[model samples]
Target: MTATPPHQHDVVIMGGGLAGLTLALQLKRRFADIDVVVLERRAHPVPHAAHKVGESSVEIGAHYFDTVLGLRPHMHGAQLRKFGFRFFFSEGRRDIDQVTEVGASRYLSVPSYQIDRGIFENYLGEEAARNGVRFVDSAMVRSLELAEDAHQPHRIEWSQEGKTHTVHARWLVDACGRAGMLKRKLGLAQANAHDCNAVWFRIGDRITIDDWSDDPAWRARCEPRARWLSTNHLVGAGYWVWLIPLASGSHSVGIVADPRLHPLDTMDTFDKAMQWFQTWQPRLYDELDGKRHLLQDFAFFRNFSYGCKQVFSGKRWALTGEAGLFLDPFYSPGSDFIAVGNTYITDLIAHDRAGHALEARAQLYDQIYHSFYESTLALYTDQYPLFGDPEVLPVKVIWDYTYYWGVLSQIFFQQRLTDMAVLGSLREELQDCQRLNFAVQDFLRAWSGVSRRRNRPVMLDQAALPWFAELNRSLNDRLDDEAFKARMRASAERLRALAMEILERARHDNPTLAAGELGTLLAEKPARLRSDAPSEAMLFEPG
Candidate 1:
């Protein structure tokens, strides 16, 4: 343990979880002369296999880890390359191929990973320290002394090895995750409308989902590569079960559901989760029944989604990761938020160090970050039931993926988080997209309400969709200011056309349905996919 003395640091970060460690590394990487200290309550070398629940990474998170932090070597070596997201709408039946599935036939150019949190986080902590960050483990923060004045440095008091130590910092960031030390103390927690819960556990042996089927054609769908490497989800109504493989010969099985549908008590415990699986996911239950004794750990959170009233402050304090806000794990956006939040925080710190106007920038970042949070929340708020409908869910997934890849992914990939000029130029377009998103979310709920659960044995290959695959691969392309703006404008138009498609589909299902903001837009300007562009009519049509 490092000796602590009322030390003065350029930045002091709390809770050395994924968010905290990553923030420290990012800060150190940008400003080498800056002294950063990270305080983690957990001891070093945390046990492998069952360290944490967020073991899956989507493209945003993976790119952040690989390109942003320049840790591709560690990611490729320590983590399992994700084989894209595979979903089984089989519900109860063990015949996976017989049930309708939504996934990629081949891996997309964009990369993600099935992260073993234990291994990944451990590496992050070590990497942070190795890269000139003072990462202190076995730390328990007892009190915080946040500076009220703009030019004052914040103060932190923590305990390590039964010794109380004090540190002063120009910036104090809360990356402590759910502990939310600053959030609780400052009363920044704001309850979101998205009330969902999750329960998950890891097993000692691998749960090879591919072996569940014996059909030669089924096995041949994705050949040579192992399906177990993919982050598999057995999706059903109001809940989805995730099967993530760990590098340490273990499988992470999780049940994330809407409490309104699947009561928390029904599957809070390991035994109850197993029994719940028996009813909804018999194959997984059957696999775990024999190895119940080898249960490594069990955890559950009721109403995990939340919003923060304030995270970025002009007072030289900020929050990142779960310490500030978290939307959902369905798309594995935890690490992505860390990347974004850290990016904004770093920009603010850079401006402050250079004695530029920070209050305006801070307020702008606050609005932008929270807006991103709200946009993401729209996808999940009261949208869990759609997970069960094989038909509607596939379309919803495509829409969601398009929105994700089109707008947000482009901003981050092109490194435009703090570009005020670009953001201002696209303000009207973004506002329209937001309104369209709200309308489409409501449409999806309404459509799912009236939709039928058709479980046809059709494999909707996301990679086969040329536009969709191109979107994934296009992230690597280098674009200039003009090209970037053009790309964003194109994405916005795509969303507008998509809104029209969703509206038509909704009206097709329910002739008496009324339109909202999107409806008005569609009324003024109809959603017209280009002649060569893919149309929704045949994508999810009766296959």
Candidate 2:
């Protein structure tokens, strides 16, 4: 059955997820005269299940939504507040919880919010509607036809109630989440180099916390704190489970693992995943002993690519959010990246409408976005083994810098487009670091060799301290004033100096010193220096 064509609009956005909605809102705010229509396959008032995954929001993401998108009221109402992240790890007899306190912390320590995507998306949808975005629900877009000339308009053919319809617009946006609907239609199904997938479901009434304290004040403080029981059990092999709390008193529990270890076809899906959870994390299993019930079966996907090669091909179309770049959820970057993409795309669209050269601006945007995603992907994937290892001290240090970098980048640096350019250059250095594939096993072997003997010979002495201090001062002056950033950069410089000193001293003290050991020691420069330094100084030192 043929359906009538709707009136042409200035912009047509495909997919009604958070990314799509955000772009629509930004576009409306930027170009009020341009008509924007969003096509979503789901029905209005989308029925979203509780305890679905992705409940955590970083501080930067929240600020963008509240401040940039102008949705503070909606966010405040639906979002669950969170202080900076707390990482727990143990080394022999010592245990550490890395906590970044608000205000004193480098990143905006404003608590991030944990929100149910279902509830959050609904609110965003409504908010977009209020901003004059016309939503076409339960509308499945079949294909897109690009116009031959830049002046000609693009066309989208879609269906509803078994009938067909066509919509024309100057711009078409593909914000479809993971499905990559538009991307697939255009034959852009590039597999992510990293083979990772996740399976998640909601657990209701299966987990409960009870306070036994008799003191009223203690109980009052303990009860509320106890409610925040979201936990991540980091089992090795690129597998981890996340337990997040929702306002409905349910927990969002899921397992993210590499397909190589736990193939989807072999496991019983939910039952096997739950059984593994029960065996590995007994404490959580015990908590849910009498309280837990499964809400749904698991959902899985692999080849989660970092960025699309062609996010924006011309003035007529642009991709935003997951459609453009889908980074791993290891650090909860999904929402933040979406907000940033929307902001940039809309800003460019606004400029183009003002008779500016939007094509050139869009090309620049695509270049920066791709570079950012590639760098991020390389950074995480290369460090995958490091993060997977609970004992790697260097991993902890990198994470400390990462946490603060996210804060500083979002709050201060990301605001300036130029900063992103500088950041892009930094990523090039990181790419080189990743290509080395510094495995954990190699590091541990070297550490064992060095720390094994009790009477280990000192290669350098107090006499060399002057040179080290001088080198440190030189590097310190060049670093950003942030305590953490300066310390990290200085630490790197110290290692380089220490490596040279070690080789020079070894050559002078013992002419027969093995070249292999010197090479090994040199290779271990940065991490070795970081580990040997006093606990209070390095970024990764556990507090």
Candidate 3:
């Protein structure tokens, strides 16, 4: 018998999860006739609410899904519109209504969703197939032979129905989530300083936080009474509990903790988690008490935050999603980064198709991607200790969201992620923002150490902050190069003003509080300085 030849495609994407499927759909959408194949290990229609962990979406991720991919109809129909992030400093307390609540009292201008992963990915697979993508579900990739040079095609061996098959492609992408077949084969795994663990599960019924309290005052705290729609966080000294609603009438719950404070062994299983919750979050325990039979799934990850040495390559191979790098899920940035990585990969593929040399482009994208990862890592690294301090965490959250919306979200919303000239022009402002963030994070930690961990009964409504709300609303504004550059400069100015306010407030409360690098970063720049600095009222006043 003669040996059979393998089928060939323009791009071969491994793993049929959210990342792989979305990449295929994006390539098809961009190139129209481009041949792409996605190999997925799991069968179609995985499950409903209990399938995956990443359920919440922020501004960037939400924009990517709702606008970039043109899935607004499906999202609006099948997913829950998020009511912004809600927080409660109700650790070890059953009275969640009395805790310091920090969140928007109403919806923001932009929207995000609480996704049902299984439903969404299944829909993505169907969409990919409709768009002429060769999606092979239940097909496990057995091995890969990545071409060393651009002229040759990379080869993939996969097994389905107990039969082996082979395929060839000009480009190869690994979106295999944590399996990271390509990452492992190429020795791309690395570690970071964030040492945290997580345990997550989905309950069969909705765990409505609004219904947990009946006080008219607490119920009326939010407009339209929709706190259940928000990605709610219950915070404590070293951990935060997430409550996200799913379209499937289930509620997703998770505990993310610094291993140093709350060890994994304390809540690795369902019984243990319930017991742990009873101790730390009695309100949640009460809600889940009789629903043990409704427990759908439970899973955990140790040291979840990781780094990849490389992702994009000149040799027509790349990695996206978890195969590349993951910072932290604190702000629901997983899908946001996926959208970003996939965009970069698609652009690289376009460059290759145009017969352009990819070495320089690939290296530049990798550098930019790594810069994003490192910058986001700063937000979570050594910051868990401050999660419980209601007084400080609200300030940190406000500042963090400002940085996200003011700088990075602008790049993505304005569709300038790949514009080298624009990025170069705004590099100094971006760097200034990053440095100011580093200093402020340090300052926050120090403030949390000395100040009173005030947990008041009032809501720190984000919408009340005029500039903050406008910064978010401005994400959809159209701007040319100069206007965009001006926006970046203004954003940097906003960050500087906010950093100064935080320093001044902290100093006023605790006169010994260190300003760290704010003295240099917040200093006036002759070329561009704002005369109208933000008022002290921008932040929540001390009661």
Query: lDDT tens string, model 1, 1-543?
Result: 333556788999998989999888888888989899999999989989999889999888889899989999988988899998888996788777799888888888999988888898899988988899998899999999888787677888889888888888999999888889899999999998999999999899999888988888888788454778888889999999999999988999999999889999999999899889889999888889999988999999998999999889877889999999989998888988888999999989999889887777888899999998998999999999999997788888888888888888999999888898987888987887777777788888877887776788878888777778888888898888888887887777788777776777767767877776667776765645555444534245544
Clashing pairs in 2: 205-291, 206-291, 206-292
Ranking by TM-score: 3, 1, 2
Highest-TM-score candidate: 3
* Clash pairs for candidate 1: none
Prediction 2 global C-alpha lDDT: 0.55
Q: Which has the higher lDDT value, candidate number 2 or candidate number 3?
A: 3
Model 2: ten consecutive residues of lowest lDDT? 95-104
For candidate 3, write residues 509-543 as lDDT tens digits.
89987666766666654224465435546688775
Give the lDDT of residue 326 in candidate 3: 86
- For model 1, the local distance difference test gives 0.86
TM-score of each: 0.96, 0.72, 0.98
Candidate that would win on lDDT? 3
1-543 per-residue lDDT for model 2 (tens digits): 134645677789998888898888878776777789999888777545452356777645766777767878777776656433323221111111211111111112244576767787787788788888988789898878877887788888899978888888877888877677667767665555766667777766424322322444433432254434433333333455565666555567766666666565543366666566565544455555555455543565555544576776656677777776677766677777776677676766667566666666678777766655654555355344333343342333332233324323332333544344454545433332322223322333233233211211111111123332332223213234354343434344443433344344333434554545335545654443444343323222221
Q: What TM-score does candidate 2 reach?
A: 0.72
Please say which candidate is ahead in lDDT: 1 or 3.
Answer: 3
Candidate 2 Cα errors over 4 Å, as ranges: 1-6, 86-108, 206-234, 265-268, 292-297, 382-388, 397-414, 418-536, 540-543
The lDDT ranking, best first, is 3, 1, 2
